[model samples]
Target: MSAPIPVKVHYHKQARELELIYENGERHRLSVEYLRVFSPSAEVRGHGPDSATLQVGKKHVGLANITPAGRYALKLHFDDGHDSGLYSWDYLWWLIEHREANWADYLDRLEAAGASREPLGIEIKQL
Candidate 1:
């Protein structure tokens, strides 16, 4: 792909929503939760080809901070205490550009694996 330029970054910091406007006139609105679950970290990616942490219960997660990595990437810290991924500008751009398709695929994979985005709510009663 060609070089990607972020023409505009509209961040509703309090709401944890980021909208990136690309130089080519494409706009992408992404939720913080989506970004967190897809983080490119060893904690999430695991080792080599036989291990990967199945990230769950991140539907309510949000970005705690967004730090620049040198001049070409973003290091995102999630409110859930995960902060070990350096997201390249190109990676972020790709995520934004293919948000819908990727997210749909994510959901499909979750379903195929008998997993869910929502955790079970437990109720305790005094008996």
Candidate 2:
């Protein structure tokens, strides 16, 4: 069997969801937070195996832009200044298929590390 190909892609800012329509007539919706935390960039996934960097404090991150990458993948630009991840079609499908398990793992890791999805507020002190 051949891999599934996307027929259309839509990003809803208010809902913070990415809707993907596949050629096989399957549709999938993925949240912005999930995509951001699981970005396929080296900055997040690292250069070698087992080097994924845990992305925290991105529960409200928004998609700034989505640019096509040579008809094989997409370059997602995030509102938090992240624009390196190239999400391929296969990767997107994998994310959709494993959304539940992946999210559970992320939550477990966050709890174990005492990390939070809420952004940290920085206070500036005036001298």
Top-scoring candidate (TM-score): 2
lDDT of each: 0.75, 0.88
Model 2 residue 25 distance off true place after TM-score fit, in angstroms: 3.0
Q: After superposition, how far is residue 109 of candidate 1 from its true place, in Å?
A: 2.0
Error of 1 at 20 (Å): 1.9
lDDT of 2 by residue, 10-119 (tens): 99989999999987788899999999999999999998868889899888888888999998899998888899979988899899989999999999989998999888
- Residue 113 lDDT in model 1? 82
Return the TM-score for each candidate structure: 0.77, 0.90
Model 1 C-alpha lDDT per residue in residues 47-91, reported as the tens digit of each score: 754576667667766666777778777788777779998878788
Candidate 1, residue 78: Cα displacement in angstroms equals: 0.6
The residue pairs in collision within model 1 are none
